[model samples]
Target chain A: MLEGILTGLSTATMPVNLFMVFIGCFVGTFIGMLPGLGPISAIALMIPITYGLDPASGIILMAGVYYGAIFGGSTSSILINAPGCSGTVVTAFDGYPLAQKGQAGKALALAAYASFTGGTISAVFLLVAAPALASVSLSFQSADYFALMVLGLSAVAAFSGKGNILKALMMTVLGLMISTIGTDRSSGVDRFTFGRMDLVDGISFLLLAMATFALAEALMSVLKPEDNGEADEDAMRNLGSMKLNKEEIKEVAPVIARSSVLGFFVGVLPGAGATIAAFLAYGFERNLAKAKEKLKFGLGSLKGLAAPEAANNAASSGSFVPLLTLGIPGSGTTAIMLGALISYGIQPGPRLFLDNPEVFWSVIISMYVGNIVLLILNLPLIPYISRLLAVPRQVLVPMILLFSITGVYLVSFNSADILIMVIITVLAIVLRLLDFPLAPLLLGFILGGMLEDNLRRALLISDGGYSFIWERPITLTIFCITLFVLVAPLASGMWKKYRKKTVGYGASMQE
Target chain B: MTISRDQIAGLVFLVFSLAYGFYATDIALLPGEEFEPINARTMPYVLSGLGAALSFFFVLASWRSAGTLKPLKLGLMAWPPVIALLVVMVIYGLILNWLGFVVSTALFLIAGFRIMGERRPKILFGVSIPFVAISWFCLTQLLDIYLAPGRLFSLLGG
Candidate 1:
């Protein structure tokens, strides 16, 4: 294990690989700085570029973008009250208020340091935990894997959007249905291609990603431009020193440490990602604080600045665990990363440790390098980086559209793919307009193939006995967990209503 | 006549699911595998049936919840720019071979910028031209991928 780690470090340090890391971070920061763009789109846009490179370099570059974008997301949150990504939404709650108080530099500094610390800590956890988990999963059978995939799909229904779990679950089912659109490998028979030659390969991952994230996002902005607030000139003038005083450091370090550990664990769960981690950390800190200190939350507390900033960055790293060990992506951005891995002909799973140790370790080590590169780039250059908010949407949106078109075209040099991209983009826009969550759709699509394969394999092993699922302890436990996750939300909602009603009755009695 | 977004979504998906389920039945099993418990068609049928049932439930839920409310409809003024952008993109995709990468991209950008309310033609031409040139150079030269020069470029003849 030590030798593998050292080998990964050496490979990541090579000149070409190191250069790709720098480029990924730089571009990722810019992408994250853009108001309407997020890490998912940034990663998607880079997929075509990574096509020609070696697997290690390709993944290193994409991973760099993932972390760099998170770091850059805090810049927009603090300066403009526009979190460049969803994960940075909680950061803006107090981050912007701090900027308004002439503490922009302090807020940004705390964010930078906290992000670095959290990321580095999470990477260490990943380095230790992923391998251990992978070895354990190596003992898993087909039944166990199918149950695990079911758990993953169910968790998406639990964690996505606030409106309706039923709606999310339906979208997931639709995604799975869409995944059935090509030739079945075992049967050599077409399933749902509808006789189109293009459908033989099923849908292209890049095309779907570009349409859903980049193109759909641009079109939505055009339909109704977001009211992204501008940075305050007065606050810009008081862009105070980036240095944290000793007192501030003493207060923030422990919060950063606590949130990093907390966020990493949250991120390790399927369907939960940075946004949940950030909110959890923020709430945890507020609840733990004394009354007077608690009042400072959402009102520019330094602890507020540190908690979510650290947690979200840590959570991004934490989300990598299941992707590496189980071959199931825990979030939307990681789903795209999983797609990139598969595109390179590398299968990610328990056997990845034995079959493709180089790909796994190098990506793991690149996170360490990426976090350092982001901290160094963001701390001093933050003031300038925030200026990206001022770029006109007319210019930025058009350029992004061009890149989406060209990137998809370059993958196969086929204009037919471009047409398919446009059609999908239109479908994505209609779905977004109706408030259908795209993340579940994407999660369903990515995991569906593996789910079907495992289901079939398990049944074959059992000679068509469905009892094998419950017969196996591992599979049974996973199904139980899935049932709990799905039911917990409904149970909690009812409990909250019950508590509210009882409290209301008590108040009426007193009156 | 006035359906909520959720209702429309549910109806569309429900119809889609039924079609998917019906079509999946036609997927033939591998030779001598007809008696197999799980085959290629099994997952698709199960998934589509579940999808159809869930979508039906969704439609009923939305209809029940939405007793009498509707979001303000988008005014006619809200759509031209978006429609124009989409149209320009379709045209651009159609013209790329005939007019080539540089020409079509430049034209698309100019139209796109104008439609988005960028009024200055100088700024429009300046940004669009340089962008197309640089991207063309990067993809064709640095990346060593070919972007067609177009029929127009061929007609011009060096």
Candidate 2:
């Protein structure tokens, strides 16, 4: 393990890799600070650009963008109460209040420190944990692999979105069907291409990503033109000292430490990401605070600001575990990263350690480098980064649209790809309007090919025996878990109703 | 009976699954692999079947529910503008090869900004021109990828 870490550090030290990380973080922070743009779109737009680079460089760049966005998001949340990213929404609850109280600098500094600490702690956990877990899966057979994939898809569908589980499952199935297009691998024949030559290669991951996330998000912004009503240019002054005194540090240190552990574990789970971690950490801290000081929480308490900041950053690192070790993404952003990895002809899974240890380790080491860089960029430069909030949607939207188009064209050099992207974008916008969560659809799309390939391979090993799904112990255990995950919510919902009815009946008899 | 959003979504998925299932049946198996336990058509068949069942479940869940769905509020700048923007994007994609990156991007941005209510011509050109120019230079020079220089440039014999 130590040797692998050293090897990774050396790989990450390459000048090109280092430069990509810096540039990615800088650009990611700049774009991610915009009100409507987030880490996903920022990384999505960069995917085409990274096509010209090596796999390690591309992965490094994307990781930097992910971390940078988390850092940049806190700036807007603190200064203007508008979270630049979804994960930062919890930060804005108390961060903006601190800014209102003339401690914008203090709030921003606390966020930078907490984010750095949480991220680094999680990075340590990832370094120690992912390899150990991957080693266990190294012995997994095809049946076990297929069962694990099913478990992953089920967890994501059940937990990621707050909407109806049936809808998420339907979307997951739809994504699986979409993956079946083009050629049937086993038969060596086209299945659903409908005679279009381009469909022979199946749909490009770039097109699906851009259409669902970047262009769809851009089109939705155009349609709604969400009122950026919270940005108050007048309150942008008096960013008091960025330095946190010893006493203030003492107050937030434990909160950051506790939340880092909580956030990292939640992140390791499929379907739970930084957004949930942040909210959970914040609520936990609120409950921990004293009654007299509790009221100060949402009104500018430093502890309130630190908890979510720490958790969200930690959660981002935690989410990488499943993607790297299991080849299953825990969240939407990581799902995009999984797609990026596959585009480079690198399949991420348990064998990733043995097959591409350099890529795995370098990516892990780069997180340490990226977090330190983010802390440096965020501390003193935050005041200026906040000015980015003033950029209007009208100006930003068209530019994003142009970038998406140009980027897609540059990747394929085919005009048809761009048209397809636009069409998919329109369809995605309609889906979004109807409140169908797009993330699960994306996760499904990414995992579908692997799921089918493994399922078939497992059956081939069994000589067409269908009973291996439950006959193999490991596979059976995973299937049982998937089954429990699917039914748990309904079971719990019914249990609560039954308890409530029984209690009501008992009370009436007493009366 | 009025359909809710979930019902509409369910219907869409149901129709798509039925169509997909029908298509899966016609996919031919590989030679000598006809009796194979698991073949190319297996997963798609399973997924389509699952999709049909799930969508039916969704429709049933939505059907027995009793709450008012949120009214679709197409605010001030609504459907017409959105539809118009989509048309503009489609046109931009169509002319991109002919008009070149610079010209097409410029025209798209100008039209897009105008439709989104950017009335200031100065700010419009100021942002659009520099962005288009820099991105073109980076793609062509830095990345060594070619963007179509357009018919006008070709006609000028550059």
> What tens-digit string does per-residue lDDT give for candidate 2 at A334-441?
989999999999999998988998999999999999888888865667677666656777787777887887777878877888778878888888888877777788
- Model 1 spans > 4 angstroms off: A228-238, A498-511, B1-3, B67-73, B76-78, B151-158
DockQ for the candidates, in order: 0.62, 0.69
User: What are the per-candidate TM-scores when only chain A is compared?
Assistant: 0.96, 0.95
Q: Point out where model 2 deviates above 4 Å.
A: A504-511, B75-77, B151-158
Error of 1 at B120 (Å): 2.4
How many residue pairs clash in each candidate at the backbone level? 0, 0
Best candidate per DockQ, number?
2
lDDT of 1 by residue, A1-511 (tens): 9988987888899899889888999889888877667899999999999998999899999999998888888887887787888899999999999998888998988998999999999999999999999999999998998998899888977897555787889878977887888888678788888888888888887888899998888777788766653346556556887889999999999999999999999999998889999999999999988899999999999998899999998999999999999998888899899989999999998988889888789888989889888888667776776666567878877888888988887777667777788888889888877777787888888888889889888998998989977898888999999999989987897899899999999999999
Q: Give the Cα error of residue A371 in candidate 2, in Å.
A: 0.8
Clashing pairs in 1: none
Report lDDT per candidate: 0.86, 0.84
Please provide, for model 1 over B60-98, each residue's C-alpha lDDT reduced to its tens digit, 9 standing for 90 to 100: 878877855456356732478878888888888888887
